[model samples]
Target: MSIIQINLTIAQMLDYTMPILFAALCGVLSESAGVVNIGLDGIMRFGAFFGLLGAFFSHSPWIGLLFGIAIGCLVGALHAFITIRWNGDQTVSGVAINVIAVGLMTYLLEYVFSTTGYSPQIQNYFGAQAYRVHLPFLAKIPLLGAFSNLSFMIWFGFICTVLMHVLLYHTVLGLRIRTCGENPKAATTLGINVFRIRWFAVIVGAALAGIGGATLSISSFSGFSDSMPNGVGFIGLAAMIFGKWTPFGALGAALLFGTGQIVQSIIAVTGIAPKLAPGLTLILPYVLTLAVLAGFVGKSIAPAADGLPYYKEQR
Candidate 1:
């Protein structure tokens, strides 16, 4: 309603945007490298679960982050092995990974903690205080102050966004990756190892997704739950599509979706428009997704060889 209120809303939106931005960045990386990684949801779950496990056992959130990254890499490798090496359908493999993650997490939680649904509260979870920065003029501003006091992973996410953009556009490796995605046959002729690039992308993307999950469980919630990621992974995929596969574009799309999510929660809290508010708030992101897709009105171009397996031909 007021300027201050608007600023505060924007601040809150940024907070919600960080995690999705990280996840979408990961999606961009994998897709750009010719791997359609629909299993970001599973990778995120692995990160959240392992983050809690590591934090609980080691009594340090940093350890949880490291563990989450390790788990994510493992999951990524598995995905690569099945889809890339075995020539399994990428979409089916991704779905299988999601299902497996759900089952594995449930089983591990029950076996280790003897808890059925969730883990115990972590006392040493990551928080804003862990990454607080006091920018001179920025901190002095009312709503802008919130930006300076962001969580450590949120800062890392932003850095990763910039780094990914550079890596995707500037480096020789980036060219190779794009080449592989655009035409594996052509890339092979150029002596580029398509499989290797795809594998690298999958692992990198999974690692980022893991960080996003750790941000949720350790930094955002200070504990892990069964639904810790809460569909943020899928939201990230939508963001990737909406952004047309660019890092900065994905970040913008993520901000928009995150704003929708926060607005939904705020409206529910305010109890304004009661019945319609709930449905509208819940469906807002998808509705906006559809609108964006419609308005863009272009052939949605994925990697030319995306979702396809590469096999060396017999001479």
Candidate 2:
């Protein structure tokens, strides 16, 4: 491939990587606090639709982002109430949230947009050239050309990865969160409020997942579709496992999966997809996800107290 094609491919890879990176980050934060959130997909769906709804009516992607974050927090609170407050099964709560998101978003899509597939498009948004950042000097530098013109969300994803690393490893709060996940009982003896910490982590993580979802509707595309987010959330969980739950690790894993996605597209665009069996090319990313997980999941370990409910009053 030409240098220009390589650069464009890298750019597309970054675009595809954003949502998965964010989802993996969500998993990291929540599971780090002893919560296993399998509902990342549902949260993304909620964020995608509500984000588009906000942008469609307000004509501002920023406002749409807030809407997505708000819904994420709301749903996160519900999950927290169930799993943390009531000591419910974490897996069940997450599955419930996912189910609710599917039906509720489907209904809302038809009720509001009067369509079953997609919402109205919002112009002059981040998906347009007017809002993308331009680094003219980077364009001529081979691989650096990928940064020449890109959406702000892509930059934000990178920034979030760094910040998440700092938050998880460098700060006191980070240590405490990890402590809660590793040993909630020990955390309680040390005066840490496990429930409160868990609540904060899950909600914040969900907000990030929401932003990931919103990125799809407002930045990656101009509007919300029934297939919005597709399976990006689940793939993110795979990335999380592949990365061993570290911010930078997730970033690398996300990039790998993103490259798979971009390659799939490149194959189709280059007419090589016709030579392949139908639907086989489309599963490239998912196949990559399974391969990574099968190779790494057994070796990677989760937090000791992860997915366990903490009932302080019982002991």
Candidate 3:
């Protein structure tokens, strides 16, 4: 309704968009390199759970963040091993990872903390409020300055997007990764180790998703919960698809979905139609995902060999 309110909404949108941004970037990287990572939800859940566990034990949120990243790498390697080394079905591997993660997190939460829904509030370090970025000079800039209060995760997400773009576009590693996805046989002929390249891409993607998950428990909120991600990882997949597998494109899709979330909150607060707000808010992202995909599905494309198991021909 006003300039201040709109700017504040956009600022909040940036924070809310971080999980999607990170996860979508992960999806883009993995899929661009010919691996389908439907397990985004699983590792995000792992990151949230383990991140809290690490902080709780060591009294350091930074350590928690590292734990999350490590788990992501392990999971990515496992997935890559299953698909790349073993030549297993990629979809089945991804789905299995998600299912395993759900069970693992559920069991750990109950057994370790004696809780079913969430973990105990992490303390001494992580229990502290997630840090925010405040630019002294920028904070004085009127309407836009209100946004300076966003979580540090929001800034991290933006930086990652730029970095991913550079990695996928400018680097020699980027070229090899793309070549592997497009034609592993050709890449192999060109002296690239196709399997290793795919493995590296998958691990890097998972590390990004780990940050996405950690943002939930360590940066956006104080502790982890069974439902910490709440479908943000899946939504990020949709964002990646909507973006046609590019970092900036995925970022735009994340912003669009984030706006939908912000609008949902606005509806509840504004009371334009109080009774319909909550349900509509809950369904907004899903509806948008389906609608956008349906509209653009025909035009959107994937890497030539995405989700296919690659096996080097015997000499």
Candidate 4:
């Protein structure tokens, strides 16, 4: 392909990768602190609609972003309460959240916006030319040209990746969180509040998932659709597994998935989708995710206490 084409493809890959990256990051954070959050997708859905609602009503995407994060925290807290506090089944709680999100969001869409398909188009930062960061000097630099003009979230995603890596590896808090995941009993003996750490992880992770959802409605598109996340959250979990639960690993996995998505789109645009069956073409990203998981999930090891409920009293 030509240089321009390569640049455009790279840019599109980053655009598509943002949500999955955020979701994977969410999974990494939660699981690293001994919580399994299968409801990341549901949290994204909640963030998507609420983010749009805030942006639509306030005419400011920033407010919408906050709305998404707030809802994510609330839902994350619910998950933490059930699993960490009450020692409920983490998987079941996650599944319940997903079910509730689907039904509730559909109902809210119809009730609030009078449409079940999608919300009305709103002023969004994602698509506006004014919101993009333009670096004209970088435009002619081959692969780097992709960075010439891009959404702020795209940059933020990369920054978050670095920050997460620092948080998980270079900081004392990171060490403590990892310790909680590996051995909550040990963490407790060291004066660390296991429940509190898990709570913080889940809530922050969910907030990031909320941002991922907002990226869909406000960054990648102008409004929220019934299928806002469209399985991106689950794919993110796949990315998390494939990445072995590391921030930079998640970033790489997300980019790989994003590449699959962009390739599918390119096939469609290049008149190859019809010849190859459009349905099959659309499944490329998922197929890639499964393939990666099949090869990596078995080899990857999780934290020792991950998904286990710790009752301090038992200790």
Candidate 5:
């Protein structure tokens, strides 16, 4: 391919990477804190629905973002209450969230809009908004210019990645959280409230995951659809695992996965092995996920107490 085409592909890959990256970070945050959050899809649904609702009514995307985060946190809190406070099975709780989200969001959509699949389009400042940000200077650069323009949420996702890395590795709260995940009994002895820490992590993680969903409906496309999330949540979890549960690592994995998803489109447009590309693109990420897990199973160890209930007297 030509340099121009390569740059365009990179830009497109980045466009798709934001949502997955944000969602994967949710998994990283949850698992790192000893809770399993497989319900990112559910949380994202809440975000997309509420975000569109807020934006549609107010014609302001910023307000829509707030709504998304709020709803995501609510779902995350519910998940936390089930798994942390009730000492429920984390995986079961997560699965329940996903099921509930699908059913609830679908029913609510039909009720509110009298339509089943998607909501009415939201109006915005750009006359109908495209969820992209085109930077001036970088837009003029040569080979690197393609990297400059992107969805605003992509930049937000990048910022979140940096902040998450700092929060997990550098901050006192992060250290406490890691201790809670690794050895809750020890953390409790050190005066850390394991329950609260887990709750905080789950809630924050959910909110972050909401950004992933909002990216779909608001930042990438300007409306909410029942199927907008489209399994990206599950993909995010696989990315988290493949990245060894680190923020920077998850970013890399997400980029790879995003590229895989966009491959079919690229080849279709470029007319490069159109027949084989479709099949390969569809199965690529999953194949990579399985391969990564198989190759790294013993090498990639999770937090010691991950997914384990932390009862005060467990030790």
Candidate 6:
């Protein structure tokens, strides 16, 4: 590709990547704390839905974002209550959340909106305009400038990644969370609150996921649609696994997946191989996901008691 073409591709990739990056960050927080958040998909769905709803009602996107975060926290709490408090199976709880979100969103869309599966276009929406950052000499750079001029969500995701890395590796709270995940028995013996740590992590992770979803609805799409998150949550999960539960690694994986998605869209627009394009583009992310999983399955190690529920009597 020519220089301009390459720059454009990079720009497109950056624009498309913010949501996945945010979701991956959320996964990192939850899984690192030994809470397997399979319900990330559901969390994203509710975030997007409520975000749009809030924007529609309030006529302000920022308010919608807050609303979305609130909704995410509520869902996260429910997940925590089931998985941690009740000692329910994490995988099952996650799956249940996903199923519930899908059905609930569909019902609201059809019944409340009187639409099949999408809400009517609301004039008041978030991210309706491009947000440009003019960095004196930096904006003149060829590819760098193109990639650097990112949306608000992109910048937020990057900052969250740094913050998460620091929090996971630096703070005493981080140590406690890690200990709980790695060795609940030991953590309990040391007077650390294992359930509380897991609950905190799970809720925080859900909030981040909600923010990610809100970004997509308010900033990326500027509207609400049933099942709008598509499979981005699943993609984030794949990224978390591929990154070995590290923020930077997950960011890299999110970028890779995002770039693949942009490339697929570009190919579809070109209409070169129209017949095969749809199927090929749709499977690209999953193909990459499989590749990553296969590549690291044996080499990568998860937290010691990742999916197991802790019980004092069992120990």
Off by over 4 Å in 5: 1-7, 125-131, 296-298
What would the per-residue lDDT of candidate 3 be over residues 1-315, giving only the tens digit for each residue? Answer: 666676677777776788888999999999888999999888898888887788778888888889989988988888888888898888899899899988899999998889889788765433244446666676667777766566667877889999999998999999899998888889999999988899999999998898888878887677878877888999899889877789998999898888777776676666676666456665765776676667744455779988877878843
Write down the lDDT that model 4 would get: 0.89
Q: C-alpha displacement of 277 in model 6, angstroms? A: 3.6
What TM-score goes with each of the models?
0.91, 0.94, 0.91, 0.93, 0.93, 0.90
Off by over 4 Å in 4: 269-274, 278-298
- Residue lDDT tens for model 2, 206-284: 9999999999899888999897678898989888877888899899988988877676667766666556554665576
Over 1-315, each residue of candidate 4 has an lDDT whose tens digit, in order, gives: 678887888888898999999999999999999999999999999999998888899888889889999999999999999998899999999999999999999999999999879789986566577778899999888899989999888998999899999999999889999999999999999999998999999999999999999988988889989977889999899889778899998998899888877776677666654556556655765665566557643556678898999988785
Pairs clashing within candidate 1: none
Candidate 2: count the clashes. Answer: 0
Error of 1 at 241 (Å): 0.4
lDDT of 4 at 223: 91
The lDDT of model 1 is: 0.81
The collision pairs in model 6 are none
lDDT for each residue of candidate 5 in 83-141, tens digit (9 for 90 to 100): 99899999999899899889998998898899978788876621133545767688666
| lDDT to native, each model | 0.81, 0.87, 0.82, 0.89, 0.84, 0.81
Cα deviation at 253, candidate 3, in Å, is: 0.8
Which of the two candidates, 3 or 5, achieves a greater lDDT against the reference?
5
lDDT of 1 by residue, 1-315 (tens): 554555566666766777688789888999898889888998899998998889899988889999989988999999889988888988998999889988998889889999877788887876745444445576567777666555677677778999998999999998888888888888889898888999999998888888888877887777778876788988888888888888998888888888887876556556665655455675766766666767754534567777777886822
lDDT of 6 by residue, 85-108 (tens): 999999999999999999998887
Ranking by lDDT: 4, 2, 5, 3, 1, 6
Stretches of candidate 3 off by over 4 Å are 1-8, 123-130, 277-298
